[model samples]
Target: MTPDNFIQNQKQQSSTPYPYPYPPPFSGPQPVHFSQYTPPVADSSILSHIMHSISSIDSRLSKLESMDKKLDKFDGLCEAVDSLFTRVKTSESDVKKTHYSISNIKLDELNAEKDNLWIAQASGGSGSPGKGSKLKKEIAEIHKQNSELKSTVSDLNLVIRPSLAHGCAVWLPSSASSQQIL
Candidate 1:
């Protein structure tokens, strides 16, 4: 049969509509079976359903990608907070250590001053009359200086101890220190 007759017979035999004008061209002289031909049927509902499913899956994938980005940002924020917390703790510890060291040094100085006062008092009584008066004046000046030092230390403790307890750093200028003393 001719190609046109074969195409017509295939069209007549199959109930479904053919997309192409005729079947694929063959190179060899093969016997054509038009009666046995079955045209492909495209169901619109099934195609639409598949397209919808693909779109929904694409949207879901996009959402998952965005959530992953948010999680990464949250992780970075957590690390920053942890780093800041560690730094604050270290600074607090250093401040406390420095305060203790200063207190110890001040106490040592006071003790030394007290010992010197005792020595001066002991020698003052045995000195010559003129020298004894001079020693008294010197001893009185030393006592005044010691009292001033004690007051200054007390003021520093008052300002610093509360700030330390609250985990705050306190810086007092020379002017501010004088104002606080008053």
Candidate 2:
């Protein structure tokens, strides 16, 4: 039989009322079937529905790709913030250590000055008053310097806190040390 006759016979069989109903037409991309290829003429509404579905899927895929790119950017920003946080912590530690050492040194100096004052006052030795006076002056100067150092450190800590928290400033160890002008 010719190809046309065969196709016509197939159409007739599909139209007949059989015990089992025929499968509905494909609304998606047509699949290649048999040696003789023929495009299935589907309903226009089915064609529109298929086209709309394909476009909707394409749009969703593009949106997912865009979200992935944004996620990468957000991850990079988080890493940068985390590194800055580490640096700020290190800087605060350094500041605290320096303050502690200075406090210890000041305490030692004050103790020594107390001893000198006591020794000068105990004995009626020559130049005793002069030595005591000098020691007092030195002690006073050390106290003044200590207070100033504390103030400076407090100011630096305050400044560093906001700058680091805001993520606008990145503190390298070397640079942070240099900026600690106390």
Candidate 3:
């Protein structure tokens, strides 16, 4: 083929799916017996075989690219599934029970703090004010911590667990007891 015709054919061939660092069309493997004046029939057969090999290589390259994309998505899905499993397992750790215990502790501390304040006011002692104020602040901090913990526990129960389940994946925890680390 003339150079002009070869260039035009290459342009058309490039529009199809091909891997990066595309192969040069006219720069195919050279024939071993270039010095020999080969017969036209032999030349034609060799050209056909080379074309077939190039086509096969292109097909395999396309398949590999597609598989690579699919494997990336699979990896992302696996990571999401793993994180969901961890959250679900964490939610089952009696968080609600822990929150309840913390609430009780906060309430008892608050009552004690109030009683100390009242005693300080009734007795008119300068020494009791510092202890009473410190107790009150500690109680307030404990209450705040308890509030955050409860909110976190509730959100895990009401939101995260259901949302994960809705995504068509089942994040199952191991049946082993909680004392064992996985």
TM-score per model over all chains? 0.42, 0.46, 0.32
- In model 3, the clashing pairs are none
Residues 9-115, candidate 1, lDDT per residue (tens digit)? 88788876752556565676554566556667879999999999999999999999999999999999999999999999999999999999999999999999878
Better by TM-score, candidate 3 or 1: 1
lDDT of 3 by residue, 70-152 (tens): 99999999999999999988886778878999999999999998887688855544647566667777888999999977875
Candidate 2 lDDT (Cα, 0 to 1): 0.77
Q: Which model scores highest in lDDT? A: 1
State the C-alpha lDDT per candidate: 0.79, 0.77, 0.73
Assess candidate 1 and give its lDDT: 0.79
**Candidate 2 versus the native: TM-score?**
0.46
Q: Which residue pairs in candidate 1 collide?
A: none
Prediction RMSDs, each to the true structure: 27.6, 32.6, 38.7
